[model samples]
Target: MSTGQGRLIIVVTVCVAMLLAILPMPDWARPFRPPWVTLVLIYWAIALPHRVGVGSGFVAGIVLDVLTGALLGQHALAMSVVVFIAIQLHQRIRVFPFWQQSLGILVLLIVEHLFGLWITGATRGTAPALQYWAGPFIGALLWPWTFVTLRKVRRHFKVT
Candidate 1:
């Protein structure tokens, strides 16, 4: 596919993934929610750093902030951090085995969660719930599946 077509596909994928992540789930399953949006963001950040930069991260974060009803900039800041790191490490991450790359993604999710906690503390005037950290923990657990599925989509659709 041409560059514009690839970019369009990425955008649509991210939008659908974000909607999936933000859709309300049962309370029990909610805590185990995979960071679908984050995963896609990281994937694109690593795969197309020039096209998907920190600004894209920031914008996506803002959209997530609005969707999740957290403090306005919380997700934005966390996503910014993830994108920055992904940009820096893209070369290495792209070459790593799938398992190793998942581990790196886990670390990035952890950092994003920590930032979320910090922001919640600042804006909500209360400590974050234990369930809050569960996001990243479960996100880590889901990384392999997410990576595999997204990879298949990319390959099938020639998104990259």
Candidate 2:
């Protein structure tokens, strides 16, 4: 794909993922909601670091914060950390099999969650809940399918 086309695809992908992340699901399912946007952004940041980076992550997070009506930097901070780690480990991470990559994604999600909790605790004066970590675990479980499907979409669209 041409550079412009590739950039467009990445932007559309990120926006769709963010919209998915904030959609109103059933209450019982909310806790299990995977960080869909975060995972997709991190995957791209790792696979196409030249196209996705911390700036994209920060913007995505800020947009999410606005959409979700959460603290301004909550998602931004969490996503920034995820993208940072993904970029830092991009070399080793890209070579891993799907399962291994999922595991790494699990770790990244957990770190993001922890940072989120720390931030929440600092600002909201609330204790963290075990449920807070569930999103990452579920997100990690979905990573394999997410990675494959997104790769297919990218290829289908003739994106590089």
Question: What lDDT tens digits, residue by residue, belong to model 2 across residues 39-120?
Answer: 8998898878877889899999899989888889998998887898899999998899988998999999998888788888
Of candidate 2, the 10-residue stretch with the lowest lDDT total is 127-136
- C-alpha-based local distance difference test score of model 1: 0.85
The backbone clash count of each candidate, in order, is 0, 0
Candidate 2: segments with Cα more than 4 A from true spot: none
RMSD of 1: 1.5
Cα lDDT tens digits for candidate 1, 65-148: 899887788889999999999999999999998778878988999999889778777777788667877777777777777777
TM-scores of all predicted structures: 0.91, 0.94
lDDT of 2: 0.88
Estimate the Cα RMSD of every predicted model relative to the unseen true structure.
1.5, 1.2
Query: Residue 15 lDDT in model 2?
Result: 88
lDDT agreement with native, every candidate: 0.85, 0.88
